[model samples]
Target: MSEVIANMSMSLDGFVADTNDGIEQVFGWYGSGDVAVPTAVEWATFRTSEASAGVLRHGLATIGALIGGRRLFDLASGWNGQHPMGVPVFIVTHQEPTDWAHPEAPFTFVTDGIESAVAKAKAAAGDKNVAVASPTVVQQCLDAGLLDAVQVDLVPVLLGQGIPFFGELAKGPVQLDGPTVVEGQGVTHLTYRVRR
Candidate 1:
């Protein structure tokens, strides 16, 4: 069975990025430590604490597919055609990109809806998990009751206001259980299963 998990590094104040769409404040932990964690993409290796490295390696090994919003896709410039996770990426968008350079890449532009994207990603994942990478997609998954778990790489900072990790859920008050915690140098990894 493939479970859908929402994962992101968030600020202590609950923002994922600053008002200018900057993530330096929240993503500093990726390079703040001594342990090296390489990804599928050669340009984006992470240097984090040993604990965070373990968590990143575990996710890289287990997550089979990724679901993200079009906004994030554009922000990352389609991750140069290959995402760091080396998994298939399913982008939820109203329309496909007209001049996408990486047509041969394993990127699927899903214009129908989140449900359809999830179905395709799950089938692609086989027995592994589908990771939701965008905050908007996470919110949608929460509203649709499709998210199974939430993984928060909590960074210690107060952004005060910016792009939040969560938004107005159509289905409010989602309950979660058992935040298995792992402390890192400047961040804390927390995983909570969604209560059914």
Candidate 2:
């Protein structure tokens, strides 16, 4: 069975990005250590603590597809058509981008909604997990009762104000199960299963 998981690196203040939508403060751990974690793309590689490297390796091996919002897709410039995971990507948007450069890439622009995107991503993922990479999409999945787990790479920082990893949920409070914790150098990886 495929699970929809929301994954993000967030600050102590619950912000994933800075006030200007910059992730430099929160994403420092990606290059703050000595261990090298290579991805499918040649241009992007992570240098992190050995513990973090193990987590990254596991994610790269297990996650078979990705779901993201248009904002994040634009922020990363579509990851140059190849995400680090090298899996298929499903973008949830009201309308597809007209100037998308990589039509041949395994990227699907889902214009219907989040549910449709999740369905498509699950199909693409087969038996593996589908990772939701955007905060808005994560919130939507939570609201729709479509998410299975939440993975937070908790960083030690307080942005005071910024783009949060979670916003107001339409469905209000959502319960979660045990958070299996893994302590890293500058981050603590926490994985919680969504309780049904």
Candidate 3:
């Protein structure tokens, strides 16, 4: 009974990552590439209203697991197996990771395919939400008709040449429900229920 969700921060122009732009530039707002792993005080405070907290605690309390793509895995440098929420992450990849970048924070790489990875993540998620956190996996889930909802933090900047967050889905015009916009300092969080 877990709902599959795909979420990410995208520029107003609809790009998740910039063209050849490093993680620091595209995802710098989160602190660093290992933004997934929050520090001790960050955990202690548990304050959602903090000025620097951009949807920080939004779904952190609900998500039970995460699914991401290979490119996102590489770009994020594997988050060194450290995720802010301490949830298990399943990486959908054709090739396995060659390095154990983060010993303490580890990732589970699924090679079978996106569906398989999602299935595993969903099972692991119990009754909580299984978040499809990578762009490629999100598109695949949408194409495969697996995702239940899509959440995006719409950033104000326009990265014109980066990889697109969404474009030409396998099916034409994926209908969306309420934007349910939540305004913050640097970004706006938008959530949509994918109309089947």
Candidate 4:
């Protein structure tokens, strides 16, 4: 079975976006000093047209499947429907949609539930990791006791209010198997292997 990895960038004060975050602004491809360090955000804001390219490269190469929510899908569609990850992808939504699948990279839409999504992603991933890229889906995975590990990169900026990773945990109780923390480039990256 493949590991369900929920990885997301959160504000230091804990907010994925403002309450009224328009789809255009929420899934920001570039760092706007919102969910990134000041130095990187500044550099990207000033120059570097491909600032987010590095982050995408690092994230996509590490996972075999990408899972996300409806809002995330809508936001990402603005990127010219480019499925940059180039792997099997799953979206947990009430509504059904389409992915402009390439002959080489085909996208799979899983709507039955989170479990179905996980199973399909695992099958698609083989031995690689299945990543839950959406914050909402990550929280649901936790609630459903489906996640095996969580990787959180705590940025320096503070949104104070917006979407959160943990909304209503319903898996009774969850324990973490020690956290590995690393402070680099002004952000603290924390990884916790889930001990369910």
Q: What is the TM-score of each candidate against the true structure?
A: 0.98, 0.98, 0.83, 0.74
lDDT of 2 by residue, 11-94 (tens): 999999998999998999999999999999999899999999999999998999999999999999999899989999999999
The per-candidate count of clashes, in order, stands at 0, 0, 4, 0
Give each prediction's root-mean-square deviation over alpha carbons: 0.7, 0.7, 4.1, 6.0
Q: Judging by lDDT, tell me the better candidate of 2 and 3.
A: 2
The number of clashing residue pairs in model 4 is 0
lDDT of each: 0.95, 0.94, 0.74, 0.65
In model 4, the worst 10-residue window by lDDT is 40-49
Q: For residues 3-117, what per-residue lDDT tens digits would candidate 1 score against the true structure?
A: 9999999999999999998999889999999999999999989999999999999999999999999999999999989999999999999999998999999999999999999
| TM-score, candidate number 3 | 0.83
Error (Å) of candidate 1 at residue 10 is: 0.5
RMSD of 3: 4.1
Query: Candidate 4 on 1-196: residue-level lDDT in tens?
Result: 5688887766677666667653223334344323432221222231112334344445556677777777787766622334555566777888676444342445555678888888888888887788887777887888888899887766677666777766667665688986777554434567899996
Worst 10 residues of 1 by lDDT: 166-175
Candidate with more favorable, higher TM-score: 2 or 4:
2
Top-scoring candidate (lDDT)? 1
Off by over 4 Å in 4: 22-60, 98-105
- Candidate 3: pairs in clash: 36-84, 81-105, 81-106, 82-105
State how far residue 12 of model 2 sits from its true place (Å): 0.5
